[model samples]
Target chain A: MNDASSQDPEQQSMPPLGADHPSVARILRRWRQLSGGRHTRDPDRKTLVACSGGADSVALAIALAQIPSSCVLAHIQHDMRTPEQAEHDRAYVEALAKRLGVDCAFGIAAVSEEPGNLEANAREARYQELARIADEHACPYIATGHHADDQLETLLMHLMRGSGTRGMSGMRPATPLGNKTLLRPLLEIPRNEIETMLRELDIAWCHDQTNDDPAYVRNRIRQDLLPLLRRLDPEIARHASQWSQDLVAMQEVMDERVEATLMEPCTITDSQWRWPRELLQAHPDIMLGYLPGLYCLRVLDNEGADRITRRAIDSWIRSVKSDSNNPTEHRIGPIVAHIRAHEVRFTPAESSELST
Target chain B: MNDASSQDPEQQSMPPLGADHPSVARILRRWRQLSGGRHTRDPDRKTLVACSGGADSVALAIALAQIPSSCVLAHIQHDMRTPEQAEHDRAYVEALAKRLGVDCAFGIAAVSEEPGNLEANAREARYQELARIADEHACPYIATGHHADDQLETLLMHLMRGSGTRGMSGMRPATPLGNKTLLRPLLEIPRNEIETMLRELDIAWCHDQTNDDPAYVRNRIRQDLLPLLRRLDPEIARHASQWSQDLVAMQEVMDERVEATLMEPCTITDSQWRWPRELLQAHPDIMLGYLPGLYCLRVLDNEGADRITRRAIDSWIRSVKSDSNNPTEHRIGPIVAHIRAHEVRFTPAESSELST
Candidate 1:
């Protein structure tokens, strides 16, 4: 490590450090801190990186390769344009893997012929392929090259689409990718830093011309919306990304309550499922999270069920005084909970509830 | 109603039946449909309009006056600037009220010693005074001339401040204000309509010089940010307002869940409550909603608990799935939930849980 750090005067020009040459080391340190400083076992540590041959993924691959563990390159070939171009991408990733002495896996997926599901389908296919490869190789983790810029773009896209907290939270570092763990080590790293690393390494990467294609929503967001956001505040991308990270962190705390309160198995009856109402009443935030799914099911089951709106919940929560002990069941979405016989049971709406 | 409709040529020109009309009417219709088509007694059967004499407010007042309900005018004297200008506003509103054969009420509030809360304090005082007057004069509803443009500005401001769904939803049509209801019937109407209404009515109103003062956040949003948004999309304000309305609708649904799931009373025994682990395992969404408030309380109670994050929640929820039938207790936020004799209980953190 010391030899590598001392080898280049160009690396020496990086921000001052006692032993670590580049500021990237500090970033990696912070990444560990953010990851709670816990490293999994070697055999269990499997990562599948979504390599796009971009500066971001290239730099990520290089950094992960430095780690003393087996790493695999997972490249997705979205067959939207020329098949030859995708082949070129595979060749580049293979060459990079060859230089690093790591195994590379290339997946070519045909774009869906159906309309409207293009972006969603492509993303789903990419992750599915990565997960499949990881499973086949007995890899526990599937890594991605999504950087700060990507996170910020995701936040804004969700914001524009009028999403709530979960949508606004953006991408996470380690989330379940099917059966495998999807880790994104480069999420906090800026695009510029990744580009710099790629340049310093004298590595060439492919630039997807589709990135500028306004037809795609993500491209439009990248080319048009992001620039406008940057103009509003120069560091907006970084700030938005930070906000997203904070939200995700907050979401984790909320998820705990959900796990603690909502995951009880109940006997499903003809109309409703019996569960302890006290369990739900105890955790307010988790209950709010469960509303949408319940509401969706309720609406589907009973068309006339009153829409469980947000204001109604706020007012109802506010009305819950410290002294209130009455067991109450309010119709929210598809789920109805009523306190009867010393138990709160949640159930679907009756067919009569659906009659307009 | 026909007489009022015939009195205004612009009202006649309004689309008799078309979807192209600014989606406000459709939203109102949908709201009625949701509410079982039973008309709630118009609390604002006789309302006093808080006219800033600006285009937005003026438009709102004009539209409300067109309704069959009796209307009045109310103006607040901030006494911030020249007394003469304040008087001019009072006189303008009085004259407008006189022309419409509606009562007029005027009140003066002293500016706070500190200026940071100037806008908020002023608005609060104004509403308080309006409520008092509404009670005295038997006006069931107090109308504010906040139109679609104001709603859009409000939504943007909330978004910039990183507020959640509740904040981003913007002004509602009818929210309880003490005994009287605060109705913003014109929230769906655009600013252009107000201007057109004023011009058509030949009603000249004074422009508040303070509006040009960029010191206020609303003014800043109107002057600096809105134009940029318009440049990106000319109908940005309209779209934003519409989005706000849609979010308001969505939020109501979420709130219904919060009410039905959370808001249960639990007895505190020595400052600790143990919830049955099975309860949380049943409804994850409800539990998630309780996390934010719980996390906030945990931070106050124990500094070490600050480390409890969203990732923990995700892991904890996953853990619950594995621990089915076997009840376990987990400390989340300020509350602890566990199984004691197969009964779930949630209790506040005792001194020990708070201790580092």
Candidate 2:
């Protein structure tokens, strides 16, 4: 590890370690830090990396290739862009992975087949395809190319939506996806640094033309908000990620309190999700905290998180958090709330399932 | 008061009550909501309001005047700007306060005599002067002109500096200031609306040149950062303030945990602050929570909050939170620690204070 304390005796905080160091060195340092002090990925364990043939991912792929760990590159052609561009990206990823002696997994996403927002569809399909690829390759950790710039944009996007602590916590460096662990090695690294690293290595990368669209809020934040923030504070991007990181730590501690006090003793049965009536009515604030978890468990079909508004949550809370503890029926989307004597139950909207 | 449910039956949340209503109505609704169902401030009790000749505070003054409450206007001429301009502002405030039948307490700030950063000095002096005026007028609540835009700017400023949850929580709607309560009736309102309110009323307000100078970090944020954020999300200003409000709630809960678990049983006697060594060592995370409370109680000179940096807090935590329970001493700014036996002791930097 780079001892910034030793380098600058006055500087106490982390001081964005390896920020001033070389591009490859910075990535190596950051990757090691992400590995929970393991220093490097074990040679025996093969890792799957999601590469989009864009500068950030391509840069990450290049860095990982230089290391000793075995790697598998997964690329999904969303086909949202032109066919020629998609094919070009696929060919590029294949060639790059092959050159680095890494196994490559390529998939075509049914972007048009998917419903809702194009970005959401592309993102969900990409993640699903990556998970499948990781499973096939027996890779536990699937690293991505989400860098500091992306982190800033994500945090800002959450702020614009008026999201709570969880949303403002931005994306985690590591998270479980189905049975596999998804990782972001370049998360600590800035976008320009990744570009610099690839430039220094004399490697070219493909650009996604769709990213330029102002229709996407994330794109607008990246292309606009970040620059203005930077003008006010030169290191705004770094701080944006850092602030979220601090909030993430704070959230973990607070989440424990919520779990211990508010959301405790709630059980998930195969047919119905249940919470005690007393617990449901006691703390109304925790209802907000518990909404996302319950929604994911209840809602199906697609990513309906955005669709599941606060109204639905409040409506649920009001239904259960009532004076009379009698069995009652309430319907919302594809879920049915069966409020009973001791507990509140949530089942499928279809009454036939309840009958079964 | 506007009951949003009555106005919009389908709306889940309050949906910004009187948002589309007249400017005065929106401000009045927000003020009433701030009162937390008290309806309005008691006419019997006087409330001191800190007003600059600026539009936001001027509009707040105008709105407050319309309501049935005793208001005392408090204005501070920093003397940092031109004498002519300062005199002009004082005259303007006096006339406005008189026109509204509100008692005015205008004061000149000793900003030049104070220490530290110009902005900090000016702010501290202004607040101190307001508190004094509030005390003189026998007022319990001192209202400030910190609107939603200012709150957003404050939050963004803290984030850029990598401040933790305490800093990110932004400002309080009400806080205990000695025997009085510091209030922000206009906190929920936006700056643009405040301007619109004044403009619609055909009331002219003084513009402070200091606010336009790019030398101040805040000015840059207002002129540059806010516009860019607005472009991405039109309601960014409102959301920023709303996000902070949610964080404040979360912080309150977490603070209870900190008080119950960590800061509980710690004692302060004479000039010495004591905490059990085991308790201090066991919870390093809670140290961040406990720092502000301890610092405020310990530090004597003015607010001194901005002076109490994270480095100083961490240093104090580290000095006391060590393995050996030996008689050792460490100093941080004006505070000194003497670690011995089962308890960590904190005293003034100089031993002369103990002798005195």
Judged by DockQ, which candidate is best?
2
Tens-digit per-residue lDDT, A1-356, candidate 2: 23333433444343432234367566655655565546444553456888888998877676655442356788887766788988888899999987665678987677776667777777788889988888898877788888887898888888888775678889998787888777787776667777876776678888855355334788777677777777777777677776767677667767677667655676866756677777767764633445445545545543444455545655667766667766777655466667787787766666535485
lDDT of 1 by residue, A1-356 (tens): 33223433344344222223263464445434433455643334645666878777767676555442446787878778677887787788889877654568887666657566676767777778878888777777777777888887776566455454455578887676567767778777767777776666567888853343334556766776666555555555555555566466555545544545565444456655565545545555424445445434434553534365544454444333223567665565555545553455555656425641
Per-residue lDDT of B118-230 in model 2, one digit per residue for the tens?
Answer: 77777777778888998888876777778888888889889888786677789888777777777787776778777877766677889955365334777778777888777
DockQ of each: 0.08, 0.46
User: How well does each candidate reproduce the native contacts, as fnat?
Assistant: 0.01, 0.71
lDDT of model 1 at residue B356? 25
List the candidate 2 regions with Cα displacement exceeding 4 Å.
A1-45, A66-69, A112-115, A199-204, A208-214, A265-304, A311-356, B1-41, B67-69, B112-115, B199-204, B208-210, B265-356
Docking outcome class, model 1: incorrect
TM-scores, each model vs. reference: 0.60, 0.79
